[model samples]
Target: MLIVEDLLLLLLDDETGTPAKAGTLPYALGGAVLVELAMLGRIDVEGAGSVLSGPKVVAVGDGPLPDPLLQEAYDEVTRKPRTVQTLLLAIGGDLWKTVTDRLVERGELRRESKRVLGLFRTTQLPSAGTGHEARLRAAIRGALVDGTEPDTRTAAIIALLSGSGALPELRPQLAWSGEVYRRAKELEKGHWGASAVGTAVARTTAAIAAAGAAASAAVITTVTT
Candidate 1:
């Protein structure tokens, strides 16, 4: 929803103390926008929350460094200049594999073969870099705005409709159904704060709908006359 997006943008701007560019805006604002839309019944809040809080692990090589070798290497490197071959032989095959795997994943180290010797022989190091946060933000924004995919566009529309209070009321007949009640309870718990703000939004939506219905009835009556 535009309102939710605007609010998120405002929050990010406040936090950063400046208007964020498109590149930076997505990372800072995407989570808030997704959360707000979920609160408004436009998106799956649970799924979004899970993605934001998923487990992450940082690997150093193919596996953990052997404790004895690691300690010795640390001391030796700090005290004397050792050759790469010397360090590899001292660290051993298993630890080196782990280290190589980790390096490849992070784009820091490359691998030519699955073999430990191959890992040691290949020696191209990637440059240190940062900017993934900006890319993530851009991707989220693109998914919302670009109508290329039907599912994404539909999600965007649902978010817009729900945030704008345009969704049809949960029918009384269906309200107490198991799924309905469960979802409602979940939403109530998750969106307690938003619900307080939503009272004003609901009232405004109701007033506008009522006014439109009345105007339509008047027009119909005049046409009949």
Candidate 2:
């Protein structure tokens, strides 16, 4: 499974299917894909910086990825180099549906829709009872709670969750504690293996913060206006 899918599974409630940290979901998802691409050697940050005056992430290699989602993100990056912040939204905007659709197709999640008030419809993505997510949680819990050394992919997942600020939401499920929080913070500081992946995580962290501030400002404006 893709890192983004794993992150989603971790963030989503098993019984309710509702995702945590909904506002930053797109950026988190997009960041996951970028990190994966960097790990695959399909993308990187331009060493000289962009003409637009910031570090620009560029697509490498000419071939397409086998997975449709990765391919789509790669095609976007191939079009032009952009700052990590730009790519996060460019690649992540509207990705909720696409990524969720892929998970549904994989039978990892089940989608249910119901009419609300007889005229409105609502959708839910409850778990499909697959043991994969259970095992995933176990691994992450072991690393965060038990101080077990995580593999590369597991480390990346922890980094993404930490950077996106969704790790705390794991709550009683992961048995949150000072040790787990500290470990997550350490992962957030990088050392996840790849330099490019670390760069993406750092930039994505800033982007998520900025995006959240912007959203909050908009909400405040709406209410005050």
Candidate 3:
């Protein structure tokens, strides 16, 4: 499974069959793609004096990416010099549909559609089996609640969850703790693996923040316009 897939599974509400939040989901999804590409050595990040100040992401090793969604992201980045924020905005637009299609194809998620008030259609994804989601919950509980040492992927998931802008939506289910949130933030900024890999995560996370800001701005403009 892809890192983004794990992220989707975690972002899902088991009983509700809905995402924890709507706004940050796409950027987080895009961030997951960026991190996965970095993990595969298919992308590189360039930074100036500081980490968050003007980080540019470039694709590495010209080749066809296995996943279509990732390939699309890779293709867009290679076409131009994009900062983490710009790339998040660029790549995140269609991530939900792409990721959900993959999940449906793999039989990991069951998709259902319903009309809301007989006006608009809405989709929901319910878990297909217990094992897939159960393991993810176990990892989260172990890391956040039990204080066990988490593997790199698990650590990244925790960090992504914290950064995902859905904390309030997720807090009750996981028994939220301030200490856990702090640890995840530390890990998000810390090195998860090689120097390059860690830098990639930090840069992507900063981008996620920027994406959130952009979303907020868009909402405000829409409301006041």
Candidate 1 vs candidate 2: the TM-score winner is 2
Count clashing pairs, candidate 1: 10
The TM-scores, one per candidate, come to: 0.19, 0.80, 0.80
Cα displacement (angstroms), candidate 2, residue 25, comes to 0.8
Instruction: Please give the CA lDDT of all the candidate structures.
Output: 0.29, 0.73, 0.69
lDDT of 3 by residue, 29-130 (tens): 877777777767787766642333236787888778898877888898899877776676678767888788888888888888889999999887887774
**Clash pairs detected, candidate 2:** none
| Lowest-sum lDDT 10-residue window in model 2 | 204-213
The positional error of residue 216 in candidate 3, measured at the CA in angstroms, is 6.6
Per-residue alpha-carbon lDDT of candidate 2 for residues 1-225, written as tens digits (9 for 90 to 100): 998888888888877678877766777788788878876878766553432223577888777687888999999998987776677778888888878888899999999998989999998888897898888888888889888877767877787787667787863367888988888766655544343345554444333333333433444467679
lDDT by residue (60-163, candidate 1, tens digit) is 22333334334333443334333222222232323333433443465433333234555554333332223432333343333333422222222232232222
| Global fold similarity of model 3 (TM-score) | 0.80
- Ranking under lDDT, best-scoring first? 2, 3, 1
lDDT at 111, model 2: 92
